[model samples]
Target: MARVLYLGGLGRSGTTLVERLLGELPSVCALGEVVHLWQRDILDDERCGCGARFSACTFWKRVGEQAFNGWGNVDVLRVHALRDLVERTRHIPRLAAGHMPMDEVREYAGFYAKVYNAAAEVSGADVVVDSSKHSALAHVLRWASDVDLRVVHVVRDARGVAYSWTKTVTRPETDGAEEMTRYSPGRSALLWNAHNAAFGLLGRRGVAVRRVRYEEFLTDPRAALIRLADFAGLTLVPDDLNFLRPDHADLGVGHSAAGNPMRFTVGRLPLRRDDAWVAKLPPRQRRMVSAMCGPMLRAYGYPVFTEEA
Candidate 1:
């Protein structure tokens, strides 16, 4: 069983940061959302973390060679279509139960399992950190026969997430062809509620999950990583803790297929909470998010501002 630490949550919730931090560990390999490998990195030939195109990068080329004997055998368009049909958020529960009648999902999961196994073999990693940020996909992988999956359910204050998703940002890898992503406050709130609830259900469904709040993590990252290390059954030595300097991480090239443009970030990283939403977001929008996510927010120890102006 290849150990997989799956980061499950809504987008813009700091999963990428957590994945990158864990990637610093010696025994863990961070594969940035292998789900998007076909479309984003492979077909589009985007920039890798190593600053080379996916196929051109030695690390990913090795991964391709190990996984498929070569990347040529992969049918990008067909696989993309199958993934869209089978990996929808609504399909998560059934997928988690291993009751998927869709042969496409099984086939895809089989392919994904092979990639993860190959990654571990080639990288010599005891664990693989997947910052896919999709509860549905994480659930499906839990039932994979070849992968041992542990989940990190990352939650953030709905207001903060709603604000982040509302802004437009560009990715360096996309050649400005596509913006990062955008969502209405109402939509982000509803999805945030649903995704977090689904991950909680996944834990009850026998998926090993460790819940981490983005706010709490930023407050004390060292403590968070300590808890995460214990949950994932990995060790974190003193050298692996490099939060002191913003340019301290000796990041190496990774064959990550897809994620935020932050994947391109190397050297030192600063840890801080983005609280811009508190002052910048309109009051009505905040109320809407608060109302939609109020109960869950309170349940998770996040404050609700529904009564505010």
Candidate 2:
């Protein structure tokens, strides 16, 4: 099995940007929203943020097709539990090996592993990036005893997330806190804490994982990705350096009208450490996040709020 990396955080926490930057590697077959909403009409495929259809690309097309064994792509993870043909046999062998099996590497790490690995091989990359952003999937990947897994937990300031949330949600990249039934002003804050916390739990369970700030990744993708590759034990090459290629707009299976989630520039300034959330958030939301995620902020090295922004 190939080295598998998962990018997870509270939604909209820059997973897309991380995917794009990692996709720069010639050896990486970058997958965004592999956990995409495949069941409910594919919520507008519009070229992914990568600029390709969820089911059209030669790589994703196969994964899209194979994931459901011809029933069609189903993005929702729970749906796999409901469907008989969702791909247990497809990955059981790979996942049971207790260590990654190079010859029989299966989807992303098992189930959809082949499609992703095939695509990466096609791209001449030896490593693959699955920016599914679904904690559920991360939970499942945890069961793959065969594959060595690395979880790249991307965290952003609650204020940064809140500010981005205030703006029109560009994509369902993350189901914003307000969108969830369990949402609360403190929800995003706890979420920011929860994502990293889960990684910690996994670590205690003896899982090998690495956590990085979304800001650190963008500030220097080269160092970040290289460090990431090293953590995964994947070999680095020149192709891996092209994470910001303009044509990286290639995307996964979604819908035509959804437009492209992968269309933005390869580089952007890191989220402001001090006043980013301040500049974008309203007083109430700022207060909520500060009050809610305050301890986590301090733990991760952010200054504690004296008074909410």
Candidate 3:
């Protein structure tokens, strides 16, 4: 069995950064957003984190070979159909309650397990980090018999998340014309609440869950990494994270399949809090997002009434 540290949360909440940092650890292999592996990597053949097309990345080629004999052996359509059936926000309740068809859920999770297991074997990593950021997929993985799943539920302020979604960032993993998805502030706010709340269910369902606030992580990345490493059952010494400095980290290219364009970043990357939302997000929209996510905002230790123009 493979141990998986699943980064579960809403999009734009810093899972990619966390996953990238975790990949710096010798015992961890970061697989970016395996939920999109079929569509983005296998079918579309987008760029991998290693700066090669997915089809050309030797690491993923080996992963495919180890996991399913080869990528060609995978029935991408069948996997996508299974994902659509069981991995959705609507299915989270049934998944948490174990009310969904167990057979179908297990079948879907089996594919993920195979990937994680193969990744661990090929990379010789003790734990594979899947920064999927999908609460629904986290819930679905509860049915994977061979997966030892632990959840790191990353969260950001609702206002920050809403602002991030409104920006037009390019998806560098694809053609220049394809930009990342954007969402209205309201939709981002509601989803921020829903996704974080869904992850809360995992702890109750007996999954090992750790909550990492994006703000706190940026403020003290060393302490954050220490906590995460401990949660993932690894003992970290100072040298294991010497690459992390007070304001930046020395990063190397990885083989993450799909994530924010930040996954493509390497070299000495500065680590700072992105509070541009405070200065740029409209007053009306900020207040609206705060109000929409009031309970969850406070639950996650964010000040709901602190937003200003």
TM-score of each: 0.93, 0.69, 0.99
Cα lDDT, model 2, residue 272? 28
- What's the distance in Å from true for residue 15, model 1? 0.5
lDDT of 3 by residue, 33-109 (tens): 99999998999999999889999999999999999999999999999888888998988989999998889899999
CA lDDT, every model vs. true structure? 0.82, 0.55, 0.93
Ranking by TM-score: 3, 1, 2
lDDT per residue as tens, model 2, 20-48: 65665545656555554354225444344
**CA shift of 61, model 1, Å:** 0.5
lDDT of 1: 0.82
* Model 3 misplaced stretches (Cα beyond 4 Å): none
* Candidate achieving higher TM-score, 2 or 3: 3
Q: Order the candidate numbers by lDDT, best to worst.
A: 3, 1, 2
Q: Which runs of model 1 end up more than 4 angstroms from their true locations?
A: 243-254, 306-309
How far out, in Å, is residue 223 in model 1? 1.5
Clashing residue pairs in all predictions, respectively, total: 2, 37, 0
